[model samples]
Target: MALLGYARVSTSHQKLTAQISELKSSGVREDRIFTDMMSGATDEREGLQRLLARAEQEDIILCTKMDRLGRNTSDMIKIVDTCYKKGIAIRFLENGLSTEGTMGKMVIQILAAVAEAERERILERTNEGRVVAMAAGVKFGRKPHQGSGMALELIHLDTPIKLVMEKTGISRATYFRLKNHQRRS
Candidate 1:
């Protein structure tokens, strides 16, 4: 079995320099490293699936931290348990723990608990924010009639929807919906 490394960042804008360096320093080869440049909440990551598929018994899975692997405790535990049952082990660099020992198991459990609580708190705050926004007539995310300046000018000039889409990069759905919305108002 090979020593596999996994790194993850929440957004595409972030770089994997630190994670890559740390994993390499820990004796994981560059070719054996797997990385996911998406949120920990998403399980459909490319490098993550590759690690899960390629890793085998006695193989080591190195990560920066527990949260980098996953946010929800249940999900994290489930993933870890899968690795454990498969004879795969995990090494958390920051925590300096390995799933090969009892203390590491305890630490992993505790970290997972804390991460789960953090996820719950985040969800609660998000729900409260949504409620406040709704009461104040504030819409979250993309809103209709929020076209670009150029698109607005073109719409006012009675330009074709296709032309507006080309100029503003707005999708066809957003274009027609915004056009009809402006006409109605």
Candidate 2:
């Protein structure tokens, strides 16, 4: 039975060095390590998809943390259930836990719930900060282009759309959107 390792980071800016090192220390080969630089909330990760497809009976899937498997409690439970059914075991290094027996399963369930609660709390805090910023008159989206008015003026003067875009550094989509807005006005 092969020991497989999976590492995940929320974005491209984050590194998987620590997790990879831990997995390597645990005797998982570099080639057997799968990684996803995407949100744990989504299961559509390419690396995860490949790992799940390649896993077989008696194969052990190792992760640095339980959250690396998934953040959603229901999804985590489903994954654990599927692994149990397939005779594949999951091991979380941080918690020193494995899906091996009744007690392990119980601990996994509790951890999954805690992980999900933590995720929700994080979301709530982020939303609260955004609301506070908005109340303080802070705009959250992209600032209007400094040359937007110039682009509109050029359009009104019958200048070519491509030239207007080049002069204003505006994309074709944005130019068209402005044109449509003008027409509506």
Candidate 3:
């Protein structure tokens, strides 16, 4: 029955001090606090994964906010659901709620729903922006093949493929493709 603290900051510029202080003030042990200074969009965070895996039945998993748990609502719900199934409790200390009772349960559901809606809205807006950009003749991703001559020159330089890639920052596939395209033309 440990009171585990989970703290996160989305980027290097942000500080985890406030979150850590809050958790500590709530009686969370220093050793029990796990943190990740990475985007919540990724599940590959080592500290976060370890905290999730180490949490056990009747343990309290505390976070500064819902967003710290995940980038969106579905992911938050998935993490909460997993904890519930394990008899582990989730406490969003800032929100003053826990998955330990009815009101907390309701709040969790509402938050999750809102997060999911927000994710959908973001995707919709991004797609609309892309459409607008396309209609305006703006490019969205990598630039079109304008450096075929340079690619061919680099390929003929007697450099190893790895060396060429290191120098050009282009993958071997792209290098070969561009060289072939230039030869064909």
Candidate 4:
């Protein structure tokens, strides 16, 4: 019946000190606290993996917020459901919520739905912004390489394809395509 703590930040630039301190204040030992400095969009975090792997029946997993557990509501619900099935409980310190009984589980479900709705709203707004930008002729994705002109010049000068690629950091396929396009022009 160990009490475990999991803390996470989306980027390396973010600090874990606050979450660690909160967990410690809640009686979780430093060794019992696991952390990851990565996005919540992926479940590939080493610290999170270790915590889940080490979880046993009746264990309590604690986090500062629900988002620390996961950003995706479905994924979060699946994780909670799995833990519940394993007799493991989850507590979110900031929200003062826990999954220890029927009511707690219900609260978690409501929160998950709210989170999912918020995510959907954000996605919709982002897509609308993208559409507006595209309608305004805004270009997205990688810009043309500045070295392309140099590569073309080298190709026109009869430089070896390998040498051109090396000098301009262009791939073999790109070099050949540009070379052929140059010939056509």
Candidate 5:
């Protein structure tokens, strides 16, 4: 009969502070909380695994939102199902939903499906926009290293690679990446 809190963020750049604050304010002890920084697309969550293993029958699993568990319907359903079979209940604080009864059960299925569909729509639109941008000669991702050209040019001039890197402020990793790209081309 414990309340275990779970918090997640899609990227390392995102913070867990907000979700952790919410969980703590909800009376979930700090020691009973688990947090992970990873995308929903990733399946390996060390924090979640430990939380699930520690949860016992009649224990409650608390989270900020349904999507934090996972993005897709099947994945969410699978997680809920696992909890249910173990006699554990899941509560989403933001939605005020609990999987301790019949009605809550139905709502979870609907929410999971809706979340999955929304994720799909977002990905589709992003791909479409990328295609349109590419057609317009737009570049995506990090701009090429400013010194890449200089490094390459210096390499061609028979300068030592280290000297070229120091002069152009190019990192060894970036220099190797550019050299690999050149080889591939």
Candidate 6:
């Protein structure tokens, strides 16, 4: 039976160094570990899909935490139940939880519910804070691209699109969009 590992980060910019290191230190090889640079809430994770497909009877799936596998109870239970049915086991290193016995399965279900509640609370708090900030005149979305204006100015001077992109670091798509905006004005 293989000791496979799965690691995930909520966003692409977040590093998986710590998770990978922990998995390696737990005796899982680097090559045996699967990683996804996406949110735990998303089901479109290629790495997780591949890992789940590869796991077989008696194999063990290792993760740092339950939330790393999924954010909500339903999703977490689904994964655990899938492994359980396949005669596979899952060991979560964070709290020393494993799906090797009836007690372990019960604990996982309880913890899954708690973790899901915690995630909901976090989202609620974040949205409330954002609302307050917006009330105080703070912007919520990304600011306009910094180089967009300069690129547009150069383009207005009849500069080549490629030259403008090279000088201002703006993409061709953005140049066209901004150029179209300029024309409409």
Identify the candidate with maximal TM-score. Answer: 5
Against the true structure, what is every candidate's RMSD? 4.9, 3.3, 5.8, 4.1, 3.0, 4.7
Model 1 lDDT per residue over 95-176, tens place: 7878876666667877888878887899999999999999999877765444566787788899998888887888888777
lDDT of 5: 0.88
How do these models rank on TM-score, best leading? 5, 2, 6, 4, 1, 3
Kindly report which residue stretches of model 1 are placed more than 4 angstroms away from their true locations once superposed.
129-179, 182-185
TM-score per candidate, in order?
0.68, 0.74, 0.63, 0.69, 0.79, 0.73
Clashing pairs in 3: none
Full-model lDDT, candidate 1: 0.84
56-146: candidate 2 lDDT, tens digit per residue: 9999999999889897888788888888889889999997999988789779989899878887899999999999999999998898788
Tens digits of per-residue lDDT, candidate 5, 42-156, equal: 4468988898899999999999998888877877887888898899999999979998887787789898898888888999999999999999999989998899999888866
**Candidate 6 lDDT, tens digit per residue, 1-185?**
99999999999889999999999999998889999988888656899999999999999999998888988788888888888989889999998999988889889989999988988899999999999999999986767778988987997898998899998888888899889998998
Model 3 alpha-carbon drift over 4 Å, by segment: 119-185
lDDT (Cα, tens digit) per residue for candidate 3, span 43-72: 678888899899999999998888887886
TM-score of 2: 0.74
lDDT of 2: 0.91
How many steric clashes between backbone atoms does each model show? 0, 0, 0, 0, 0, 0
Please give the CA lDDT of all the candidate structures.
0.84, 0.91, 0.83, 0.91, 0.88, 0.89
CA shift of 25, model 4, Å: 1.7
Off by over 4 Å in 6: 139-185
Q: What TM-score does structure 3 among the candidates reach?
A: 0.63
Model 5: how far is 149 from its true place, Å?
6.1
TM-score of 6: 0.73
lDDT of 4: 0.91
